[model samples]
Target chain A: MAYYGTNGYGDDAMDTESSGPKVTVREVESGRCDFVLQNCPLALANSLRRVMLAEIPTIAIDLVEVESNSSVLPDEFLAHRLGLIPLNSMNVASGLQYTRECGNCDDHCEQCSVTLRLHVKCSSPENLLVFAKDLIMVDGRTDDIGKPVIRDSAGNGPLLAKLRNGQELKLSCIAKKGIAKEHAKWAPSAAIGFEYDPNNKLRHVDYWYEVDAKDEWPVNQKNAEWESEETAADFTFNPDAQPSAFFFDLEATGVLEPDEIVHQGVDVLQKKLAEIINGLTRSDEGMNGGMSPDGYEPAPAEDDYAYGRGGTTPYGATAYGQNGYGGY
Target chain B: MSNSAERDTEMANGEAEEDSADEQELLLGGLEKLVILPGQTSHAASFQIEQEDHTLGNSLRYFINKNPDVEFCGYTIPHPSETKMHIRIQTWEDTPTTAFDALRKGLEDMIEACDVVTEKFTDARDGFEASKQ
Candidate 1:
């Protein structure tokens, strides 16, 4: 069977039947992780990176209303700030549809959007800080909407504004599901990138030869300690130890885990490839069915055979027969 | 098209007839959401995007880094796991909106290129089948 490349797995680490592509976590935290991916092309790695950055869906504040604002910020400015607040999206993956596509409402409804209200009035003389904690889900709708109310997991909501004494502010906001491709708020990964991993290189020199300087090769020079034979160094640089392997750094937004971002990216990539394959297959089936270029109907089978054999004239000359007495 | 026009009219009329109802306990806001705010060379826009952590903030920063006109671009999530993403952008000689326009354009170009690739693949497959027949 033909493979995608001549050296199907590039430059060193050969793949056995059991070892195709290996992914081992190098480091992981609540928001970020790094992993080593072996035996995969750089192209696939980059595609996954792009998919993680642009394709994942998350919920965000889509609309806002400022009923009254005596604060220093303008209404639009305050609304703009309110819209930038991050909401927990644990429920997004469970089939929460985009508000535009929701069938139940014209613009938005409880099923498509969750409303948040922020109302604050400063009575003291000192400036007051308005934080995310102050914003509450309206109408006890969090339960009614079936979407969890976005909470300030950090306990203290991050500060939004500072209001002087006697300044009052009131606003209402709505959150909805969306992807980062439409807006940056929904991007799943905080940071994602990859670099090629150096592979081991083996060298067979005269038994007494000393290994070259560290600057000469990019791989770690510590592997030179493995030279066993005294006369012939038989040094192995370990440059090809992990061929076609890459070190990937991935950081997830609070909405998803780092591993889930990678998994979802691969899932999206597979789905896209499947769609292309399906489309190509459909085109092939249509053509094989003898569909005309502009239509789906197949060419008449008998007519095709008769035309190929020259058994019928192009304009029906056989109807006139040998004599010229045929009716017009 | 007609449906869109009707919706537009309804939206316009809805905005015209509205004043915030005080007794409703701050629950009455319209459907029109704030997407991007206008500015001179530097602009700040907030979207209702739930960027739980640095994912979107970093991705957008990466994207902004690719634009020559962008002077600086950054995002902050004021509340964790809350649905708000604030993006601030500064551009070199161009309006802040241009930076966002470029980002949108880049996305559109990628989509168009992908569509073209799919179309070409379909055409090639059909041609191969037709020749075999």
Candidate 2:
């Protein structure tokens, strides 16, 4: 309701030292939720979105050792598909260690990693659809931790591969801790839908239209509460208006619950800051003293700074420069 | 030759035979830095965080600037390849807090804010499930 071009949050949102967050959750279904964050700075909102998408570490299959395969899918292709399967890693961040950081063993030890094995052979006359449920943990050691998330009530999950009759496949893989930035398989969220200035009141996007502006773009349908009553398609432009509200519609992968991802993401963000704070307490050691580190030179600057669109054709150039259509 | 740094890369400097090593090195210490600006007290300093970009920088700026005692707070990623952010903080003259304390508070605020979102999202989720049944 606050997205109706209200300037009430102009001073308060910026001035308040610890202004409490105002959240309105519209809908919450399994693996998905629609919510609005109000009275929060756009930068802070973006941080949350970006952190949840890439920073929060999640468990996923990193290395796969194939034993045998007679199935139609190649070993590399099958391993890639296995990496995409969402594992149940709820509340396990505290226990897992990133394999790279856990230097106790060269590659992986019990403390740093977990193992899952799959060995199946088809004897039936028809082809068999192999699923993630078939991949069982060695010794069932992680039974308390959990298994691959079932895609449906029938216990069917992501299809890893298909095997014709008399075909056999065997594989043993290791799951390791990682962040989405390193590889997307570790990402916990299916999608983080970030929307700000839903009415385009900030004019962040320049609309391209051939005729009447209203005909090409309708008043935003999201603010139906006011748009329905007030059919006018325009409002006064406020050049100094800062974003004080935001809307995020997100969907969670089965690896973690919606709330857990937000919590872990915040933890990771704080940990990163705390590292810098810790660096403040440490002695400088005279800054690269006694030891020598290599040096770097500035990037080779071509005339790229003044390199405007000199090659633009006459017709295309008319839409930009001093006509209020600023070229980036 | 006087200001070689400002000149473009392709420009030819014939007179100056100065080796590249003699010129000042950019980022000599490989992103690990917490140097205080000359003539400034401990109350105002800069911190360099490694392996991070704007996701933390812009938001942390907003949080630290929220402090009434803070005089100024800002951050920048010196280079894209460096994967680090340099944050500068300056607190007010008479404030009890220091630059380091301001950064610590800003980071703590983000954690608490996350708790708020986690709680609200959980409640909304459970409430919706209850109403559905």
Candidate 3:
């Protein structure tokens, strides 16, 4: 059969049976989890990481209308801070429309948004620390989002700002559903650490060292454990070995669970493939009808940054050099 | 008498093909989903999936290789800068299966695998939530 380098993938862990891939959850908590995804390559593993980081949708404060502000923070500063607070978005996908698709109303309406009002006037003489919990879900429309995600269940959540006595900070903020690619606030996971070949069995890199490289270098316990019996007896590099097991150290914010992030990550890839299949199966003429040709248009910037929010948007930086052979 | 015209058309087609292959546009409705390489039998063939890297190619190969009918299935991204993924599939010669059939079946299998993961994760998620209370 001369398979893809019959001995290339020196991975005994590769499962050839029809049983499919395996996911063994290790230490799983409400906000974090450790797991190993087996019987897959780096491509699938990386796709999961990318999806969890930028594609998984979550609810965040997209827009904030400050009715009055006597607090220390400026309006946009306050708005940006409010936007960062993680909102409980368990029902976002089913409950609200992406502000862009909600053509029902140009302004805030039942179809598109959930209104969160923050009205606080410090009557106490001492300083006041305003937390995300203070942003009351006044409108019943917010039933979809539920409430803020407080990571420390026993303690008060993220601190928004501090105010002195007689100072007032009043705002009617709009929280909307979005993905991290558009605005970081919507990112479900704060971080995702993924590794396919932690021991570097693939020999992807050559370690540079001076004098007696092997004798000088110390072999870690984990790396030594991975060494086969023959290799442990005598060092022999497998030039064509392939990576099999993938370890994921996924840490999610209060907004989404570790399992949900992984599921949605795979879902992003599935939907992508389904779309490709649909495009291919369709006749050439009608192929354009269903497929969105205009690739990823980051959901319209919810914040106009009329607050003079100068974003460093690099324009026309990508230049493609001609690579066509003079004669074919 | 029409030799020049035929040559010009051939060159044009070649350039058009090169143009499409150069640009990887999986979701952009630009490139064709699959480009079957030339001069291979139905049982063994190389398919170039456009605008895709190892993410789809390697995962798809894993699924297709699981099929007992498949003798061999592997994929390679031609170059780092280029987004095209060339997947080579070989089925048992006697089996009535074609490489194209294996790819389609692999895609369905991948979807099934995704459903399984979602199901398992859902159970875990519910447990996590239940413990939160």
lDDT score of model 2? 0.64
Which tens-of-lDDT digit does each residue in A34-107 have in candidate 1? 66554443444455577778776667776777788999888877766665666666546444655543435666
What DockQ does each listed candidate score?
A: 0.01, 0.14, 0.09
CA deviation > 4 Å runs, candidate 3 = A1-18, A142-146, A153-155, A208-235, A284-328, B1-109, B119-133
lDDT of 3 by residue, A1-328 (tens): 2112112434433444244455656567668987766555455666667778876767888778888999999998999899888888776656666553343554446555778888888889999989987888877863647477776765568998899998899998888766675567888898987765433445565556687544555654342343332222143456656655666779998787777778777887686566445434442235332223342121222222121111212211111111100000
Order the candidates by lDDT, highest first — what do you get? Answer: 2, 3, 1
User: Distance (Å) between predicted and true CA of A207, model 2?
Assistant: 2.0
Local distance difference test, per candidate? Answer: 0.48, 0.64, 0.62
Chain B TM-score for candidate 1: 0.43
Task: Looking at model 3, give its docking quality level.
Answer: incorrect
RMSD of each: 24.5, 14.0, 12.4
Off by over 4 Å in 2: A1-19, A103-106, A142-146, A218-220, A223-233, A282-328, B1-44, B68-71, B90-98, B126-133
Chain A only, candidate 2, TM-score: 0.79
Chain B fold agreement for model 2, TM-score: 0.69
For candidate 2, the TM-score is 0.74
Q: Write the per-residue lDDT of candidate 2 for residues A22-123, one digit (tens) a residue.
A: 666766767876777766677778888988897677778878899999998899899899899888877556776544334255456666577889999999
What are the candidates' interface root-mean-square deviations?
A: 26.8, 14.7, 15.7
Candidate achieving higher DockQ, 1 or 2? 2
